[model samples]
Target: MTSSDLCATLDESDALRLLRGGQFQLEGRLVDASNTTLRARLTLDGVTARCVYKPVRGERPLWDFPDGTLAGREVSAYLVSQATGWGLVPPTVLRDGPLGPGACQLWIDEPDDAEALVGFVPSDQLPPRWFPVAGARDEDGTAYALAHADDPRLAALAVLDAVINNADRKGGHVLRGPDDRVYGVDHGVSFHVEEKLRTVLWGWAGRPLPAEAVEVLRRLAGAVAGPLGAELAEHLTTAEIAELAGRVDRLVEQGRFPLPPQDWPAMPWPPI
Candidate 1:
């Protein structure tokens, strides 16, 4: 089936089943990825969809994160997203692929005319409801500002990034799915025990948390204290899971969005 067909017919549970049990065939490599990432087709019980597969053996070692753990972190991000009921992440699962065990996530196809929610805009012409996070200069000396929309969907993702300690939420990582949902991808560098939150979605920093977000956090607190925490333990360390819980509680208590970190760079390099 085509991606649109799959999106129309399959719900989250069906997508999860296909990701966990489907056969993967590598169609190509995403060369721009820092680690090996394969674009492939997943098939099971005559249902087929495109998926991105990142094999554990192909993961590159990072200085802060443990080696061979990125794939699991990707899955963990999905779980947290699922728990939020925000559906900000595509369905993802850790399963055996052609190369070995890895993360298999249902691919989201963006529409051709989908406007970017996070990107560079002319320095002096910030769009209404858009917030600027940083400034930059082009090779020709033109000025630009890194920014993102004030939309609540993007706000939900920003909160998710904070809880996951996502250290690499580049602009390119945000996609507007054909269904019009805001989805975040490339979460392999997340869930570190350290305070490594970095992203392009700092527009809502220091603002009051949206009421919807507060309700989600309340549910998330319970989930973390119960079954969701157990599911995460399979992919994250005990310390990391504890830290995740702590972050959520603090957000609930503070009742506001987190500010950019003072020690770490507030945004990831190559913001787009």
Candidate 2:
């Protein structure tokens, strides 16, 4: 999508107009950042925060991401995270349209200072070190996956993201919250529900499936026949939903962690 694709044409509330600039001053630590967006620790109105700011550039959108202004992308991520509870995203500080058709979104926090794996996620960050690569480990020899996996809410997020075809659920995008829970960040790329299932989650490739993981998939399959499936249908087509269901079934039947499908050319850097 391009800047031209963005404008006050959608049936959004007046907030769309006020989304082009800042509503209040922001001050905080430069916790961590990336080439496209910067996150800082911030506080406002007696609340603590993590701020994310994206500066628009060029005649074309830099990342082949949706041609939304900063505010549009942030708002979309926040709303989707809230709806799905996968927590793989950032919060919305504010959004408003700008001179002509520009806009921006202010993010209040960042769980870590690392960028999401762009392409060919290195070996060190793969599972058990995060998959395909090695880095960190726990006593049972697992690479310390999301702490929220035990929570039904978090599991729902994984399932929903899979259903939505989230293309960037990499290690860095999942943040470790202060409560020691997990949060997902950087959701600008999501909701396609195609064969874009590239991920580092299969580091244990070829290993027998864990019983616990099986439970999560089962619960998701059950939900798919109900509210989850119904809701997904609103944003995606019947074919997309079937494809998503197929993915889950594949994981279950394989009965073992699968390896990254490096068959296609790697997703382009910047993915734009």
| Highest-scoring model, TM-score | 1
Clash number for each model: 0, 28
Clashing pairs in 1: none
| Model 2 lDDT, residue 45, Cα | 32
lDDT of 1 by residue, 134-221 (tens): 9889899999999899998899999999889999999999999888889999999988878999999998899999898999999999
Residues 161-239, candidate 2: write the lDDT tens digits. Answer: 4444556656545554433445655544554444554443433446665666666566666666667667655444576
- The count of residue-pair clashes in candidate 1 stands at 0
lDDT of 1: 0.92
Structural similarity to truth (TM-score) of each candidate: 0.98, 0.49
CA RMSD of all predictions: 0.9, 10.5
